[model samples]
Target: MTTIEAPSGRTTTPDVQHIDVLVVGAGISGIGAAYHLQHEQPGRSFLLLDALDERGGTWRTHRYPGARSDSDLFTFGYGFKPWRGPSIATADEILAYLDEVIEENDLAQYIRYRHRVTAASWSSEERRYTVEVTREDTGEHLRFTTDFLWMCQGYYDHDKPFQPNWQGMDEFRGQTIHPQQWPEDLDCTGKRVVVIGSGATAATLIPAIAESAKHVTMLQRSPTFFISRPKVAELAATLRALEIPDEWTHEIMRRASFAQGEELWRMSVETPDALREFLIESMRPLLPDGFDIDKHFNPTYRPWQQRLAAVPEGDLFTALREGKASVVTDTIERFTETGIRLTSGEELEADIVVTATGFDLSLFGNVAFTVDGEPVDFTQQVTYRGIMITGVPNMAYVFGYFRASWTLRADLVSQFVCRLLTKMDEQGTPVVVPQLRPEDADMPLLDWSDPENFNPGYVMRSQHRMFKRGDREPWTHHKEYTEERDILPTADLDDGLVYRR
Candidate 1:
């Protein structure tokens, strides 16, 4: 990396030093980008920065009691970095794996920790980005200009928690907390707990909290379709014994699993009555006799239309069956002094309340972006292959598919970024950006996910800001990494993404 002084009063680094590539967020996307860049372009210059002192974005940030990856380890693990742990890796294990990847690839040298990028502006005259970043430790600020930017920053923002305006939440005289900001020293053992919202986080939080909490009441506005399977360790073991490469094995298993789910999705959407009856029948035995499973278990949308909750080996169902846990499918009327009042005139008393509502999905912390000295609104921009933002030259953001393992999509995005950069270098292209035609608005790009603005208000917020193109083809989300493999690394980059030589 080279540093150069600029005439704009701020001491800047090489438009080239920070140039070849500037990867933000040290999570899966950042590590993946650095890993591929080092291998593909050995002599290229780059830097990776994260807000935290250590690496491993989400895996490091979230330390809830039983945090773990919902995706199978095979698919969740980096394609190049095969996960040797259980198929479903605990949060700790995932963090460790990220550490291993960083050390093994010697990516530490390229990473500048605690350097949180606040804003990035594209320079029209120089054809690069002027990034403003602050050091988290000393409050020291610095401005660095770069030729290219790679946003490996995941969709969610760290500081913001999704807390909806509850009728009497503020009036309650107790401590309330959101799972994303779970207190490290929190002690909920033997205390009555109420975890609100029904999503993946809720699923994970319920089981873990039930292990110690006196009584964990799960409150949901509506019941979500849930499926359970064995953890990744078992699956990984079976695949390893057969001498299958981790990525290949992972892709095959995940693809098959998703295909089955997709078929079910089709059924739920095509034959709503049959699917509803099937779901009711499956969950009939769990609820009290004469209880309406249709009211609670049935959703307004089709299965897999949003995201399906992954339960571990029917643990959640078993917990409910054994009477250790209970579910209340009702809206919160208000928060009482000691507990929450339901819309059904029922009071659920709790010593502690856990909001497992879900996450707020914002792209890059909702930072205002400028390309070529022109302000770019993400809502006004279209995503190139759902990775590169239009009008932003030489930059790529790694976002995941709702239907598949996150790492699979992220790794693919990382690989494609490296390839795109290599091609740019070979062709002597200094800048590249998506140049979608004005008439290309009719093409679909994303799947239908949480359209009702449900779960953890942040997702709804991000969805509103996101450019949703409903096409399920080359631009659509397939959720299977194998099917998408050829599409990214080998896709005609020049078709949608404009490359200037």
Candidate 2:
């Protein structure tokens, strides 16, 4: 941190927090970034700031029943940490893993909870960024300066889930809930329940709630492919039984899992029918007789176009088999006094409605950024190596891979930044920005995600607000971890960026 001195004979006051690096968000990404910073660039003063009052990001905020990770834990776990749990880990398990990461690396001392960063503007003359932050508890604003900024904030609006307007929705007498904001005191036992949407949240909620609800109905406009994943990993168990070191076990598990996922994705992209049939066949035996996989489980989009929903130990299928839950593939035309009216002229009765509709993506946490007092529009800037935005000095944002566990990309990004920072120190350069070459002036900017083809609602909604991508090197991102592994961690930092001494 930088020092402050008052005028002669006046008491010194440290009004502004200054540091070599300022990491935003104390969640998975931010914690990993801080860890790598301390490991690779020792003696650098940095601070980790989070708007929430805790360390866990996604897990800490979402408190709904049956809320858990769709992605497996071996890949989701940080590179430095070894996960001892099964692949299908719960939210609390993931939170515990994050806590372990923080304690083992001694990162808790540098973190400030309830510190929300409002804005950041880069000053070319000062070669530093002026950041505006507010304490959530007191609403008091503060200023900070840093040579570099790292954003670990995930995408999505934390305030509310995406809820569409249906006529008479508010007039309904039944209770309504969003999975993100599940009430702690509420009871669902012996009550008719309706869960809107067929994504991961709905998939997780129906089975978990069906055990208590009088009957649960999953209402959806379309279908999402469902797959049953084993709660225990035989290979991980085998590795441990063989006395392999924890680090090797972690690597082996990650690689084995990656290969399987890659093969599945490749089959989706190349021969989607084979993969789709395999998935449907896998589900057929788990459901009751005459259950229609085509109407309820099969998605119109090809496999891997969007992530498939996973259920722990076939709990969802068991719920369907036990006749505790049913699925409706129709849109809501209006809300009735008792429940909802479907566009297909069907009526559903419910005592509670859970709108798992989806999330509204919020880019950069709605924080405004400027360079030299001029606002920097994300639409005009192209991403450099899918991390740094063009012409933005001393900043990198963590955006994980959509096809794999989020931490895979997060860990790689942290490692990449550490490498860049190390090289910058050796070169005596303090500021670096990705500069678009003049030859690429005619390159047309495209949405970072190909959501039309992908059809994931969250990315489709927020694509316009994000940075653009090009078709060429360092301007585009591939979903394959092996490609990212070969490029991101060891990419030459001096190749395309402008560096200042």
Candidate 3:
């Protein structure tokens, strides 16, 4: 821990004391919260603690052979930090970028690495939170309290990988791997591979494994409806220009690109049938001539009902079209001697198997939260603009838009939260809570995650209840910035957010 002078010209320590804010998790969201909190409110004291020794939550944990961002770099990057590299950035590059941002902002002083927060209990009488954390390296437990608690801890538990129960999965002779916990020593040189799951992980894994594997078959219980488009060069270029010091140019292109994504999202939901057919047609050439598009591409649910895989460089489609990658729409009954046995009474042999099945959506580590020692379950809570979980006060969690670059939404959420905190101080409000009214509860939460909902990962599970049903634009996720601004701006804080004494 390093020390820095607060705005009041006093020495300050982020840890070992009651802070203005206690942010859990050192991932992008946590970093964003800490960065903005310090930059915008230097006088306010806050501490960022992570269970892991280092930052970069998901990006740090899941480092498979070909890990990279499928979303455009411009949109994927933090608003405060400009992504100067090519449109696509590798996992390592992203992790480096995160570290760079922390260093540039002098945020390391506030971060306590290897400190895992076990449980948090809110004190209504004190109007504060008491948190319990364990040091991973020292094996010592410590207790601390803060005026507010921010659950920046991402949705997945590091120990729990979403491994589905395949009947014969244990009997497989070939090695089995999950991308989340990919082993460093594992190699797939000239090996025949079978990747289970047709979601983002499978899409990314198939292409990378194709380069080294003799053959890689993407075995999906059903076909996933994916959409592809050219790299948003215009958007990227526009963001680059805005990253300059000039505020005018920055605001112009920022609003433009934001509105553009919003328009696209609107177009997607308004004309579902034509767009759905167009998407199906777009995929026809990549599949076998007589392949059943209806069975594979024609999902049972509506479009954007679950996440639509982004084929930025068409890597997955390129592999399929080049005969290097193939998709098998079959159910895996269990693990076979060398591969997977399908429910169709057939066997596909492989040297290794990768399960990209998906994730579990248990919010906050399936851990218990208590206010004044009374239990508080996030599932029993409502999300405020998908940020701060209701019934929790003076704290905020920043996540990305389901349809857009996560950072885009994260950036906005960070800004809004900082402004909210500032507003609270200005108004002498000690506590703020965004509680949804009964009428608002009648509104829908969209689930743009995996339709099948088999894997219980964080993002998918959150999406399952994050948005209103059928209200795709604002409720689910708005890829566009224009619409998001209207809903996320500081002026809209009065919608239902309550500021308590």
Q: Per-residue lDDT for 322 in model 1?
A: 61
Q: In lDDT terms, how accurate is model 2? A: 0.87
Candidate 2, residues 1-501: lDDT per residue as tens digits?
443443433233358879899998888889889888998789899999899999888888788888788888899998888888888988888889888888888889999999888899999999999998877886666789999999888877776778878899988999998888889887899999999998899988898889999999999988998889888778988889999998999999998989989899889878999999999999999998999889999999898888889888988889989999988889889999999999889999999999998888777787889999999998888898878989899999988877788889998999899888878888999889998777778888888787645778887877778888887877887457868988887787876788997
Ranking by lDDT: 2, 1, 3
Query: lDDT value for candidate 1?
Result: 0.74
Number of the top TM-score candidate: 2
Itemize residue pairs with steric clashes in candidate 2.
none
- Prediction 2 TM-score vs. true: 0.95
Candidate No. with top lDDT? 2
Error of 3 at 4 (Å): 30
RMSD of each: 4.0, 3.5, 6.3
Candidate 2 residue-wise lDDT at 276: 97
Which of the two candidates, 1 or 3, achieves a greater TM-score against the reference? 1
Full-model lDDT, candidate 3: 0.72
